[model samples]
Target: MEPVAGSLLAPLLLAGAAFSNHLTDSYGATANYWAIGLHISCWIAQFVGHGIFEGRAPALLDNLVQAFFLAPFFVWMEILFLFGYRPGLQSRIAKAVEKEVDKFHQSKLHGNGRATNGKIIRTIASLALSLAVYKYAHGDPDKQPLLTRWLHYYDSMQEDFKRKTYMNIKFVEEAGKDRHLFETAPFVGHMELKFPE
Candidate 1:
């Protein structure tokens, strides 16, 4: 296929290169303008021809390599088949194309790849959920998996609050009012603010 495609395209490609080279030799830098115009026009013609003759968008829209490189081989093979090149191979190809088309149609009906993607996502999510449930049900209560740890976060927070409460001494506003208590306090000779009772 590569050799066939290369052989079919090389002449045209070389001719185009030669033409551009000739333009550059004759017209200097101005040749670039003409070459650009021709290049654009050729691509335009390619897409227009695909629309008119094939009645569908060009393969370039979906796959550039298929349109540019492989298309010539495919077209050549089809032409060969028309002239009885390989009947058996052609029949097999036809069957395969038919099967693929049917598969495509079925997938389209099932919402065109979304169903498959959704099924995968659902499977992953269900497995994660099931694993979480199993861990919460049977695993040692001391250590929890990262995924299932959030369920106990509030309880852990409450325990932390209890610990924090035990660690802190109560603050009494009147303790500062007694001069002896204030004198014996660690903050000696520090300026203190006293509010009226």
Candidate 2:
């Protein structure tokens, strides 16, 4: 969310710099200096918001070219949400965003786990690593169980990938536990597993 807001505000800073150049041509050196200073200050504020307040890298650092254009449009949509517009699509968009974030975390774990050897050791290490990463990423105590369940699914998928076998996996959310049903092999039958939170 902070990344999105930072991305949205970035273009305003660019516009300010452009306006400062126009000021230099017409208004005088003093006006240009003030405009440039304002632009610099705002840029610093954006970085502080992202790095310090948000606890995440600014979106620009990840993809400078895309951030330059996308930030403003994203902010516009956020503004609409704030105004209670598009109420119906909010949950759908939120779920999609959650999936993307989960995918990113899973990929990060996979990348870090590649250095380790041995299937059992790697699986155990990856599970621990994923739990730690998810905990840090979420920062909400109540969501720990959900994160654990997500890591369980992720671990299963990792195992399936290594075996070069496709598994039909289905996730069911229940009151007391999260259940994952995996059809490992057609003739072998289905495996029902419950991951502890």
Each candidate structure's count of clashing pairs: 0, 0
TM-score of 2: 0.37
Q: What is the C-alpha RMSD of each candidate to the true structure, in Å?
A: 26.4, 27.9
> What is the C-alpha RMSD, rounded to one decimal, of candidate 2?
27.9
Which candidate should be chosen as best, given lDDT against the real structure?
1
lDDT by candidate, in order shown: 0.64, 0.60
lDDT of 2 by residue, 1-197 (tens): 54654676678879988885586556654563465457657755775675466444456555766568777666676786798856776677778989978875776566744432233354445446756864675575654444344555776898978665433222223312432233332465577899998
lDDT score for residue 133 of model 1 = 66
Q: Please name the candidate that would achieve the greatest TM-score relative to the true structure.
A: 2
Would you estimate the TM-scores of all the predictions? 0.34, 0.37
Off by over 4 Å in 2: 1-26, 102-197
Deviation in Å, model 2, residue 5 alpha carbon: 17
